[model samples]
Target: MKQEPSYIEALLPILTLVGLLTMNVFFFEDTLAGSNQVALLLAATIAGIIVRRNGQAWARTMENVVSTIGSAMPAMLILLLIGSLAGTWLLSGIVPALIYYGLDIINPRVFLITAVVVSAIVSLATGSSWSTIATIGVALLGIGKAIGINEAIVAGAIISGAYFGDKISPLSDTTNLAPAMAGTDLFTHIRYMLYTTTPSFIITLLIFLVIGLSYNFSEAVVDVANVKSAIDGAFNTSPWLFLVPLILFVIIIKKVPPIPSLMIGTLLGGVCAVLFQPHMVSEIAGNVPNYAEASYIGFMQAMFGDIIIVTPDADVNELLHTSGMAGMLDTIWLILSAMVFGGIMESGGLLTRLTQPIINWADSTGSLVASTVVTCIFFNTTASDQYISIVVPGRMFRKSYQDKRLKPEVLSRTLEDSGTMTSVLIPWNTCGATQSRVLGVGTFDYLPYAFFNLISPLMSILFAYLNLKIRRYELDEIPVEERIN
Candidate 1:
C-alpha cells in the first residue's frame, strides 16, 4: 500500500507555487501567456522530485501523472469541440442571428437583467459560457456600452448569466466533472445541484433587475436600432439564422454526446452559411462571381484557419474575426500545464497531504464546505488553472464528505460554486485568461461586478452554516462495489 504525504511536504509545494504565480500575474496581467502553466509544471516537478528522493519509484510518480491527466481528457476534448463549434457556428449565422435578435429584444431599461438572462439562455442552448460571451456577450457588452451602462457591470452581468447556464446545463463539463469525481451520476448531481443553484439564480436575477431598471430605455433603443441595421446590412439576417442554434440545442436535448453534437452543429452551421449567406462567404473569399466555390473554400478554411472580417468601421472590424482552431491553443496549453501540476500532486500524494488538516478538523458540515471552498480558492491561487481547482480539491475532499454523512452532491455543488464560478475572478487562471481574451475586459476590471461569483462563496459558506438543503449521507444509497471502489 502507498503511504500518504505529510502536510508540511504537500503545503511547501503549494506555497512556492502560489508565491510564484502571484508574482507572474502581477507582472503579466493577460500577457504571462503560458508562464502560469510553466509555473505549475515546475511546482509539480518539485513535488515529484521530493517523492522520488524519499524512495518512491519515479515511474510510479509518473504513472500517477498519467492517470490524473487521463481522467481529465474528456474535459479537454469537450473544450476543443466547443472552440470549433464557436467558429463554425459563427460562420453559419447562428451566433450573428442570436446577436441581432438579442439586441432587438433587450431594451435598455432592462438591459442588465436582460443581459444576464440572454447569456444564460444561449449558454444553456450551446452549453458554453466561452462561446456565449465571445459572441452574444461581446455584442451585448458593446450595446450596453453604447447605452451608457458601466462596463464592469455589463461584463459582470454577461459572466453571471453565461456561467449560470454553464453550471446548470446538462452539457457543461464542470457539471459532469463534479459528479464524476464525487461518486455520483451526472443527472443526479445536476438535479441535486438545483437546490442551491436555483436560489442563487433567483438572487442573481433580482440583483440584475434592480440594476437594469435604472437604465434609460429610449436612448438604448436608438443605439440598438443602429446596431441592428448595421448587422442586417452586413449579412442576410433572417429568422432562419435562429434555426442553427435551435438545432444545436435540440441535439443536446436528445442526449447526443457533446463532441459529436457540437461537430454536427458546426457542420450544420457551415452549410447554413453557404445557403443563407452566400454573399457573405463569397465576399470573405474575395470571389464575388464563384459563390459556390467561394463558400466551400471559405467555410473549410474557417473550420481550420484564421479568418478576419473587415467592415468599413473599426469596431466592426474587431467584431468580425475568427481564429477557429488557432484561438484554442493558449487555452489548451494552460490545461496541459495544469494537468502536469495535478499529475505530480497525485503521484506524490501531495493532494491528500494538503487536505488532511482540513479533514481532521472539519467536525461540522459547515466547516467541511468552507474548507472545500477555501481549498478551491487555494488551487486557483497556487495551481493557476480552474481544471486543477476542480480536480485536486474534488479528489482530496470526497472522502471527508462521505465520512461526514453528507451526500457527494454537496461537495460537487460547493466545488462548482467556488471552483468553476470564481476562476475568472483570478487573472492567471484559464477561465480568467479565456474570458479576458473573449470579452476584451481586464480580470481586475470585472471582478467586482461578477456579483454571482463574488457572492457564491459566501452563499455556499452560509448554506453550510445554516444547514440549508445540505443532504445527509446514506451508505445504503450506493452499491457495495462502489463502496469498495
Candidate 2:
C-alpha cells in the first residue's frame, strides 16, 4: 500500500508550480502565452507521481482529474458561446450600432468617464466583459485615440467599467461561478457584493472625473460624423439590432438558464446578420456562387471561425473582426490544464494541507476572509486562470467559513472582489491576456488606471477588518441552505 504524503511533500508541487510560473513570466514576457499551461501539466505530473507513491491509485487520480474538469465544462461551454455571440454581433452590426450611437455622446473633456460608463452599460446589458471590450470598448479606444487621449487610460477605464458590470450582472459567468463555488444563489451573492462594489465604483468614477477635467482637448477635434459614416457604410446600423440584446436581458431576467439564454442570443445575432447585412454576408462568402450557399457559409464562418469585415478606414477595420467559437480554444486549453493541477492538488490533499496553516492562523473572522482573498489572488497569479482561482479558493475555504459561522455570501463576495476583478490585472492570466488582446493594450499599461479593480480587493479586505456588514450565521439555525453537498 502507498503511504500518505507528508505536509512538506504536499507543498512541493505548489512551490514548484509557482517557481516555474515566475520564471515563465520573466523569460517569456508577453510571449509567456501557453507556458503556464505547460507548467500546470508538469506540476500535475509531479503531483500524480507523489500521490501514486502514497498509495493513491493511478485510476483514482485520473478519475478525480476527469471529474474536476467535467465540473468546469459548463463554464467552458459559456466561453465558447460568448465567442460565437461576439462574432455574430459584429457581423450583424449590433456592435457597430452601439459604437455609432456611443460615439455621438462623447464629451471630449469627459471622454474617459464616458468610456467607463458606456462600457459598464454594455457589459451589464450583455453580461460579458469580453464582448463589451471587443466591441464597444474597441470603438471607445478608437474614439479616445481620435480625441488624443492616452490609450492606456482609455483601456483602463474600459476594463474597470466592464469588470464592474460583470461582477454584478446575473447573466455573467463569473457572477454565476462565484456563487456556485461558494455555495450561494446568484442574486444573494450579487446583493451582498454591492456593499463593497458600490463604493469601489463610485470612487473609480470620481477619480476618472478628476482626471477627465484636468485634460485639455481644446485643439483635438474628434470626427464623430466620419465614425458614424464608416459604420453606416459597412453595416446596417439600426436600433432594430438592439432587439437581440434586449431579448437576451429579458430571458436572463426571467430566470432562463444561461446556456439556453446565450444560445438564444447567438441565434438572434445570426438571424439579424442574415436579415440586415446580406451584402456583407455575401462578401464574406467570397464566390460561393449561390446566394443561399454564400449566406450559410458566411453565417457559419462568423459563428465558428474567423471573420473580418474590412472597412475603408483602417481603424474601423480593426474594430470589425471576430474569431467566433474557434477563438475560445486557447482559453479552454489553459482551463483544462489548470483543472488537472487543481484536481491533483485536491484529490491528493495537497491544497488542504497547504491551506491548513492559513486556516490555523485565521482564528478571527477578518483573518479568515483575508486568507480566502489572498488564496484566490495567489491562484489567479499562479494558476493563470480566473475560474480556477475562484473554484480552488472557494473549495478550500468553504468549510472554514462554515466553522466560523459566516454566511456563504460573504465568501462569495470575497471571491469576486479579489479573484474576479484582479484577474485582468495580471499580465499572463487568461483574463488579462484576452482583454489585452481585445483592447490592444498591455496589462501593465492599464493596471494603474483600473481604479475599480484596484479598489475592490482593498474594500473587501477593509470591510473584513472592520467587520462591516459581515453576516454571521445564527447560532440556532443552519448557516446557508445552499451549502455544497
Candidate 3:
C-alpha cells in the first residue's frame, strides 16, 4: 500500500537540512561541536514524518536506518583507531621526528607542492587516503605550520594529493567499487580515469607550486630553527623512529584489512614510545613509582586520553598534544546523525524521487554524463556517504549508458571522477567529517584550496561535452536502421 511521494514532499526534508546547515555557519563558530548534529536530527525527524505519511511503515524505516548505520561502523571504528595512533605516534617521537627532520630538508618555498607529492605517493602506496592523511598528512601540516604556512591551505594540499592517488590507485576501495557497480573491470576504469584525472592533477600541482613560491619565508627560517630546538630538547628524534611507519606501510601494502593494520600500528607506536622516550612517558604517567608502572600508565593514557608535551616554545607545545581515542567521539556522533537523515530519506524513496527529474533530462552524451556527475554529488550531499554516492548513481545510470552505446568504463570513470573526488568537500559526509577532525581544519576552510578535488568533476564534465576520450560500443553491434545517425 505504499505510494510515491510528490516532489514537494520529497524535497522538504532536504530543504530543511540545507537551511539548518546554512544557519549553523552564521550562528556557531564550531558547527560540528553540536549544532550540526542537531540540524541532521531535526531533518531526519521531518523526513520520518513525511515517510510515514507516504505509507512507509515506521518499522521498516527503522530497519533501514539500522542497516545504514551498520554500514558506517567500520569508518567510525577506524576514526577511533586513528585517534589512538595519533597519540601514540606523538608520544613515541615519530611525528615529532618527522617534523624536526622535515624542517631541515623541506624549503618553505616548495613546501606546499612537496606536501602534495609526498601525500600522493603515500596514499597511492596504501590506497587509503584516510590512513595517509592521519599519518604523513599530520606531519606535513605541522611542518607547514612551523614554517608559517596556512594550516588550512596545507591541509587542502595534502587532501588534494591524497584523493588524487585514491581515485586512480588499483588498491583503493572506491576505485574497485566504481567498476563493480558499472559492470567494468578495475584496470579499465583506472585507465579511462587517467584521461580526466591527469589533467586535473597537473593543474592542482601547478597551483600549489605557484602558491608555494609566493610565500615570504624570511621569518619562517627563524621559527623553524626554534621549533627544531624545542623538539630536540623534548624527545629522542632518532632515525629509527621511522621504522614504525615503514612497518605500517608494509602491512597496508600486504592488503591486511584497515582495522588490524591500524591496530598493529597503534600498538607498535606505544612500544616505541616506551622504549625510545621513557622520559616523556614517565612525565605522562605523573609521579608513578617505577618505570614499569609509568610505562603502563603512560601507554594507557596515550591510547585512551589526552597527552600534552609542553616545551619552552609555546607553538611547539600546541603542535605536540594529542587527544587519543576520545577525540574521535564528536566525529562519530556527526556520522551517526548524518546516517539517520540519509536512511530515512532513502528508505522512503525520497532520494529517488528527487533524482528522477535529473535522470529524465539527459538527452545527449554530454547531458548524460553531466547528469550522472550531478546525481553523484547530490547523493554525497544528501546521503553523506561516499560509497552510497557512487553505488546509487552507478545503478541509476548504467542502463542509460547502454542505451546510448557508451562503454561501461565511461560510466565507471565518471563515478570515481565525481563521486570519489567530492565526498570530502561536504561537511556532513563521512570523509569530510573524519578528515576535518583529523586535520583540525573545517571542511569549508579547505574547500576552496582543495584544487584537485574541485577541478576533477569539471574535468570530467568538460571531456564529456567535448567528446574527448569517450569510448563507445562497436558500431556493428547496433541494428542497421538504429545506427542511421
Candidate 4:
C-alpha cells in the first residue's frame, strides 16, 4: 500500500480483497467458515494503515468505519429480527403449518412452476425473500427433490421468487439499499425497478412453467408424515398459534422498527409456547426445582438464545430449532466485514476508478443500460460482495445517468437487474454460499435453473438493444423500439 496514491492507485486494496477472496472460494472452499469476512477486514485494515502512513489521522479512518456501520444498522437489525422471527415462527407453527399445507397441495408434475409461483406469492405477501426461503424454500427444496425435479431447478425457482421480492418489495434491504446509495428514495427505486424486474420475473416464471410441463415428475407427493409427525410431537401445532406470526406481520406492515417488532414476535412465540408447548419450554429452559422460574428462564433462553425441541421423530428436531439473536451473529459479522471492505473502497476512491471507463463510454441509452448491467455483474464477479456490487455501481453511475438527463430510477433498476440478481450465481458471493448451503445445492447445480438470473441480464440487454418499453432521457421522447444494437 502506498502512502500517497491517485484514484487508480487507491484500487490496490480493493484488488487485494478481490484476489484473496477469489482464492479462498476456489482453492479453499468450505474449509473456512468466515474466510470471506476475514478477507474484507484484512483489506480494510490495509487501507487504514495506508491512510495512517499518509498523515491522515487514525480517527478519520475509525470515523469512516463508524459511519459505515451506522448507515447499515437498520439493515443489520432487520436481519437479526428475521432470525428471531424465523425461530419463533417455527415454534409457533406458522412455518411448519404452512409447509404441511403446501406439501399437501403441490402436484409433482408442476413442482418447478409451483415452487416459483408459491414462493413468489409468499415472498410478495411477506415482503421478504429470505423469510420465504428459510421457511417455505427449505421445505420446497425437499419436496421438489423428492418429486424428481432437478435440485438446481428447484433452487433456481426458489431464488427467482426470493429475489423478486428483494427487488420489488419496499421492505427488502437491497430494495432499500440501492436507492439509498444512489441518493434516491426507497419507493421510487422499487417503482422504477418494476420496469425491468416485472418483465424479467414474468419471463422467468414462464420458463419454469414450460420446463415443468416438459419435465417428467412421477414421484409421489411427500407423505409429509415423518415431518408432520416430528413437528406434531414437538410443538402443539394449531391454527391459534398462527397468531404469533400474523401479529408479527401486522407489526412489520405498520412499519415499526425491526428491533421492537422482533422483540414482540419473540415474546409472543414464547407465550404461545407456554400455552401450547409448555413441555418444550421446560425442556429448553432445562430442569429446575421451581416451576415458574424454570418456565421463565427456559422461555427467555428460547427467545434470546438457542432452543431445540426434542421429538420422538428426528425430523421434528430439524424443524423445531431456534438460535434467536445468536443465530444472526455470523451473517451480521459477514455483512460488517463486507461493509468495511466497501467503505475502504469508497473512502480510497477505488470504487469510482472501477467504473470510470463504462461511465465515460456509455453514449447512447442502449449503451448506457448495457454498461450499467455489465458493470454491476462485473462488480459481483470481481468484488465478491453484492453490497459492494450495488453500492459501487450506484455511486459510480449516478453522475453519468444524470449527465445524460436520465432519471436515477434507470440506474437503480439496472443495478438490481445486474447486481442483485447475479450475485447469487457467483459461488464466491455471500448470497451464493448462504443460499447454496441453506438449500443444500451447489451454485453450479442451480445456475442453469436460475432462469430469472440467467435470463435477466439477457433480457436487459435485449430491451436495451430493442429499446422496448425503454423510456428516454427526455420524458417527451416517444417510447418505442428504436435503433438496434
Best by TM-score: 2
Ten contiguous residues minimizing lDDT sum, candidate 2:
476-485
What is the model-wide C-alpha lDDT for candidate 4?
A: 0.68
Assess the local accuracy of residue 56 in candidate 2 as a C-alpha lDDT between 0 and 100.
87
For model 3, residues 1-485, the per-residue Cα lDDT tens digits are 88998999988987787677667655776666788788889989999999999899999999988976775676566667777887898899987886677656556668888788877765664467987788667777877887778999999999999999888764466776677657665566777888999999999999998898877653345655777899999999999998988998677667676668878988999999999999999999996779999998999899889989999987667667778889767767877786788778888888778767876788888999999998889878876667657765765576678778998899998999899999999998778988999899999999999999999999999999999998888866743432211
lDDT of 1 by residue, 144-238 (tens): 88878888889999999999888887556577667656656555666677777778888888988887777775454554465566667777778
lDDT of candidate 2 at residue 427, scale 0 to 100: 85
Each candidate: RMSD to true structure?
A: 4.5, 4.3, 8.1, 6.7
RMSD of 2: 4.3
Model 3, runs deviating above 4 Å: 108-203, 206-220, 361-450, 459-485
lDDT tens per residue, model 4, 327-417: 7676577667766766665555555566576666877878988888887888788867676677666756766666666666667777878
Model 2 bad stretches (over 4 Å): 1-4, 26-33, 121-158, 165-195, 214-227, 287-289, 379-395, 398-412, 423-448, 462-485
Q: Give the clashing pairs for model 1.
A: 405-473
For model 1, what is the C-alpha lDDT against the true structure?
0.74
TM-score of each: 0.79, 0.81, 0.69, 0.74
Clashing residue pairs in candidate 4 (N, C-alpha, C atoms within 3 angstroms): 285-298
Against the true structure, candidate 2 reaches a TM-score of 0.81
User: How well does model 3 score by local distance difference test?
Assistant: 0.81
Answer with 3 or 4, whichever has the higher lDDT.
Answer: 3
